[model samples]
Target: MNETIGAAAAGPSDIAAAAGRLTRAAASGVPCAPVRDLIGRDDLAAAYAVQAALTATRLAAGARITGRKIGLTSEAVQRQLGVDQPDFGVLFEDMAYADGAVIPAGRVLQPRAEAEIAFVLGSDLADGPLDARQVRDAVEYGVAALEICGSRIAGWDISFGDTVADNASAGAYVLGTERRTLEEFEPVDVVMSMSIGGQEVSTGTGAACLGDPIEAVVWLARTARDLGEPLRAGQVVLSGALGPMRPVTAGDTVTATLSGLGTVTAGFTEGAAS
Candidate 1:
């Protein structure tokens, strides 16, 4: 897999070294330098290879895959990165937090929060054209979600490959309780308002997510399937951000409300020394 990544530009040793750097950063609660020098910027396959290595280690340690999260869904961001499509990260069971739960500050490095629509899949999306209809039909319900993003790369300075290798800067997530079927609510029609410490900080409509959040899922379904891991039943899909991501600090309370999907909140605690 490493040899195939980036057409062998980043070999097995390179992938291992990159993964080791990120693992240490996460373990020490200290951000590390970018891995682009090792993996090469724009080498997406090499970056994903690094991410896969880390994920494999985690799974070996008993962590389980829960779902996936889409990133770079913003058209502006895509243009800035010279890419037309978004990237994705694997979600682990340990990365999920209950709505209203207080997250430990030390659990993530340089955390940020963004509002998103969480789609809980009711069926497999392993085959077919994976069009908008197939993606929507596979959804069991939609709920408001808070994605707590963090970067292991120091100062959040990253190139495309850097962020991808860092698992799309994924940290954790909170899912709302209210579940509305596709018929009950249209994803592109919902508006989002997110506040921290009772102050509005981010706001956007579902259209901000690749024109529609469902479209993001369609892209993800195809991408994941092509990569050999297809979207399956009961896995939650975070359909990219509905708005800008805001930096989060210890003790900050994040609350996001999505029209039709309801609200979700996450609290940050004063961290313990890591």
Candidate 2:
């Protein structure tokens, strides 16, 4: 598995070293290549392995695993990335901010926003080949979530591998006002709508997420287990998006209205204060 990643000029060590550099940049507000150089490798498995390692380092360093995020799920985003599928990543607890929390957007490199449905896990999920039933059983609540997508990519040329390693471009997330119980809302039939700056931008139904979000959660958990980072209890998983991702800038306010759950809003740091 690693030999494939070694095909890159940087090799495994170089790729691993780049991870440290990435952490430093993210912490110190400096900038560097965002796993794109590693993505140039011809082997898909290798690139993904590098991402797993990068994510593992954060976990080992005490980063709390909160939930999972699935990107490129929308057909439009799939076309933009030149892929017909979605990529996934883990969201850390510290990365979650309550709605209305002032996000110092300056720290982000080209931050954007996307509203998504967030699933709160009630129990640890370590099952292999996990099914939608398991996901449903493990989830205790659902809420509207807003994912703030920040990327180190100067241009929008990032590939699936690059996005994957960058944690699906996840920087921060916002939880909405209400928590809906599974019994209250049949997640499979819930509708969702997203608006940016008061203008509707993305919309779809809960069914858009691979029939039901629980299915996406099942896939994420089983897949993460295959990668060696099984889902943990209390993690907030942002299922796939209901629609395409829109570009957001400073001062932009965004909200996602989830039928069963409610709404969550996050405002980008205003220019002078951004």
Candidate 3:
């Protein structure tokens, strides 16, 4: 929208590597002012073309497609973003960490914690009216997850394009034990609690995510359809964050509980051992 961004809108290459560089920057917790400067460019459409190209780069690198994440999926977040709804981003195998794992802090530019519900897909989902039952039926199980969001754009007010190009600030995440399926339990009505180093931090209900976490899953299904990248079987879709997001630091321990769903834990380390 700005004059500078107006010029970037015409740059084809801008879209090609924006997301990838932003991803790399976020993972390493480094400044990416170069990318941030192009936000709101009139050249954004072509830039997104370039940004979308990175999807092929990841696929070519043997990074398996896992699922997608719906971010800002709440009225509160929408207000924060000055938008009506939320946005979504792609997820790959490289962004995942098993439960009880110690995350290498060196990889993330700036790490933050968010509580989420993950839905493992049962079949392919494409554009169409979303059904709560279909989402419930497709759900294999639920896990308590910690979404490690990061950013590399120094100090900037990210526009929709900026956030999207940064892979929604997705750094890494941890998945906990499974807790049946949506059909077997109330995934959206649960009361959740989170702790850091054995200290209570946030509390909320699954309703915090667009009223129902399943609805969040449904939202992802429809969004992917719009993007021509619908959900596929075996893909795990992570719902939006519940409660407030917490920042991560070296040597910190985090544990999140989803009432009936169980718990997930992650530890942060300065770097890989020598």
Candidate 4:
């Protein structure tokens, strides 16, 4: 019989160092070496561990945890990243903005925007696997949302490990004012359109997001619970992007409108508080 071998696990110091590198890159607004280069590539568990540690570092620095964001739920993004499943990251209070707010371009490195449906939970989701219906029932309402994703990995050269260690490449997010209850909204049938400077760039339906945006939320709830952090009530959940992400540069104004949900806008400026 032949014996099977597994990849070596990363120790505490390795995880801490990798997390520190990511923290430095994010704070400096400069890209750094991929985490896989510092730690080995095959240890996804270690990469997530680094992500947790990185979140802790931010929390210690006065950042408050707002909610979570799901990534790679779209088949296009999954294919782009060469992954078959989804990944998630923590969202911070400082990362949120109201509709039509101008985002500080200087704070983000290599920014891009994606349209998504945002769910605000009415009840706490505890540990265990949840179906899409179960996930949908818990939602208080859904709103139009735009996620600003930024990569700390140089030139966006990222593997799964690199992205996971970089907080799912999340930078900031904005939510529109329109809110509709589950009874009035069909999570799987909603259509979305995104435009930059009044030029249509991408279009997709709610089905593009892991079959339905509700399914993405369910996956996040279960995945977070398994990771020892359950989804809580009042936390905003970005279900995932409906279409391909579009590059965002300084002075760019991006808008996304959903079928039932109203439109949301985000403007980027060259400096802070534009």
lDDT of 1: 0.92
Q: Candidates ranked by TM-score, best first?
A: 1, 4, 3, 2
Candidate that beats the other on TM-score, 1 or 4, i.e. the better one: 1
The lDDT of each candidate is: 0.92, 0.72, 0.72, 0.86
Q: Predict model 2's lDDT versus the native.
A: 0.72
lDDT of 2 by residue, 72-108 (tens): 6666666777765567877777777898776767746
Cα lDDT of model 3 by residue, 40-152, tens digit: 53233444453466567778878787888878776876776566656666788878999999998865656788888887777777634657777777777887888887666
The 10 consecutive residues of candidate 4 with the worst lDDT sum are: 1-10
| TM-score of each predicted structure versus truth | 0.96, 0.85, 0.86, 0.94
Q: Which parts of model 4 are misplaced by more than 4 Å?
A: 1-8, 127-129, 272-274
Q: What is the overall TM-score of model 3 with all chains considered together?
A: 0.86
Which candidate leads the pack in TM-score? 1
The digit string of per-residue lDDT tens for model 1 on 76-194 reads: 88888776778899999989999999998878789999999999999999999999999989999999999999999999988888989999999999999999999999999999999
RMSDs, each prediction? 2.7, 3.7, 4.3, 3.7
Error at 140, model 4, angstroms: 0.3
**Model 1: residue 209 alpha-carbon error in angstroms:** 0.5
